[model samples]
Target: MKSFGQIIKANSVGKVVDFDAGVDRLLPFDFTATNTELTAAMLDDTELFSDWINKQLANNNARYGVGGYNEHRTIYSRSAHFDTSEEPRRLHLGIDIWGPAGTPVYNFYDATVHSFANNDNFGDYGATIILKYEIAGYVFHALYGHLSLASLSGLAENKFIPAASQIGALGPKEENGGWPPHLHFQIIEDMHGLKGDYPGVCRFSEGDRYLANCPDPNVILQFDF
Candidate 1:
């Protein structure tokens, strides 16, 4: 049997997103301590973070700021969600699309709502949605994090969601775990019986294993990042 990543790549044609028409250039964002662009002062303030992101986009002449797959970041320190006695989770596992709040997000392929939840902790996922997809007898999952609270309304388990269907909107600071609006997109090879939530980051030491299970989201988003 082929791995989930290989199957996704085989059917990558007609996936989702219009980078040239709807989306602008996809900027590579760095949140590591070595990156001077994102200051420590901006860590707790969502407004400041959004302003910094906007400036990065403006300076680059891009409409959206993206990247952060397997990236070692220092920005996770604000929340205990990424911290542990052993190691801090700084390696990002998802592809984040930084854009304005309330930007509509679409399902890339035919799927059904598996679960939804509001991880209301500070610097958490806020309103999140997970969808399940089956292809060639192999089942996989997709996660959309940092969504508007309103996006979770009326969602139920196993609800059918068509390809390219507008599913939810990007959330703002007050509702999206106190961060700038962005879509945390991830493809999961296995849910591990999880729902509505999954680790979008992992420790640097576990990069190989975590990355193998969570493949590049560009397989679905099709963004040339």
Candidate 2:
């Protein structure tokens, strides 16, 4: 059997977020501890963090700020939701597309709605959608998080969504777990019997296992920029 990443690379996928990588510039953002620009105060204040994101895009002449896959992000310190007695989950497992709220997110392949929910926890994926895809005898899933609550209003499980169809819109800070507007996109080889949500971050020690289950989304994103 072909590997999950290989299967994704073999198939044709659509843009999860509408943008022409060839025409529009995408900024690679760094939320790791090395980025001195992300001060503690700035990370705690959503408005300040958002302003900083916009500034980065504006200065770089980019349409959207992207990145965070397998990143050891310090920004999670602002929220206790990621904390535990043993260790905090600081390693990001998804690619974030930082842009304005209400930005449309599309399904990259033909799929059925696996599950949907409003997580509502601080630093959580406020409105989440998980889609199931079966390609070349391999079954896997994709997760879309930080979505507007309205996106879940009429959605139902097992709803057939055609490729390139709009799935939902990015939510504002007030709705998207109180962070800057962005779409959290992740590709999962297995759902682990979980629905509507999965670990988008994990402890640094668990990075290997989590990363294996969650492949690099760029294989499907195909962002040339």
Candidate 3:
């Protein structure tokens, strides 16, 4: 297999970042970010450019991809918190880059539309797209959940995803299940051939299995932030 070091970048320093700062940037959320030394501008979010990640989750939503190590673990998983609704909450499988709607999203590598569907639910990913690809002989897949309706209009399975292709735009809160606009990206080694649906969120009991198979999307994204 090829080393993901070649496919992804750390934090948000990628082609998509140029389109909008909100799209990607290495936040001081990780230990390395703090080690790099945070600037006054990085601490201020009034401009809406700084990352809102913290030990305490904002608006009862799960905390993901933030902490002292920049490792995976949710606010609910932390012992200091008092919320019981989200048990086994140890962060998330994907990095959530909060931003505005209509933010352009693209394919990280060449892939084919494995499956897709409009998951309409209160806390569900509004619209999702699953793409399959191969890297250095490793067959794998990526899921882009919580996309906008416009992103899925007229889309079909088996569609082509050339490397660096623009697949769709991010959805707003209203259209994307009332959360801040962000892309829920997850990597899959084995799709099990399921189509139009897969579990982006699962019970804590299955966390280990998912984490092992999922690995770090940043492995390909190269976004260490």
Candidate 4:
């Protein structure tokens, strides 16, 4: 079977946002140790992280700070949520869009609401929504996390959401699992029947398996960075 990324590339469907910027306008954000601006203190402080993201946007004159697909980030160490007995989950499996809170998020294609929930935990995806889509005769799912809690309201299973429709807004720190305001978008080739939520980060040892299931979200977001 063709990979999800390949299928999406051939279809030439819709987009996740209504932005008019090209890939050049997209800025790359670094949350790893190589980013001299980041520190242990900043990772745990929402205000600091938000300020850092703002700086990145202003410095680059970009509308969005993107990247982090398959990236090994040191920021995950701040939360025990990613820590496992054997290995830590430092590898990011999604494309994070760093932008202002309340930025509207749209669906890349027509889909049905698969599930949603307010996973109110420290360093977690507070409000999340998963959409089920079928393309090229294959069924797949998309997970939108770190969204405003209000977005989950009125959502029902199997609810039809039109392509490019406003699905939700970027959430605040308190509502979005205490992180800097951003959208965590992931493309899942298979959900394994899971709903409402899925792991957006994984351990290094499990990178191959998780990366296979969760392909590069840029295929849907279409942001070059």
Candidate with best TM-score: 2
Best by lDDT: 2
The candidate with the higher TM-score, 3 or 4, is 4
lDDT of 4 at 79: 86
RMSD of 2: 1.0
User: Who is ahead in TM-score, 2 or 4?
Assistant: 2
Give per-residue CA lDDT, model 1, range 45-140, as digits (tens).
Answer: 778888989888888988788888888889998788788659888899999999889888888888999899999888889999999898777788
Candidate 3 per-residue lDDT, tens place, 1-225, comes to 344445443222233222333443344344222233434454332223223433223433332232221243333222222133545434456655544567678886777888888777645667888888766566778888768988887677888867676778778756665444667777777777677666554446667876666767756554444
* lDDT sort, best first: 2, 4, 1, 3
Candidate 1 off by > 4 Å: 12-18, 21-23
* Candidate 4 lDDT for residue 76: 88
Q: After superposition, how far is residue 7 of candidate 1 from its true place, in Å?
A: 2.1
Model 1 clash count equals: 0
TM-score: the better of candidates 1 and 2:
2
* Segments of candidate 2 deviating more than 4 angstroms: none
Across residues 57-142, which tens digit of lDDT does each residue of candidate 2 receive? 89999988889999999999999999965789999999999999999999988999999999889899999999999988888899
Candidate 4 residue runs with Cα over 4 Å from true position: 22-24
Model 2 gets an lDDT of 0.90
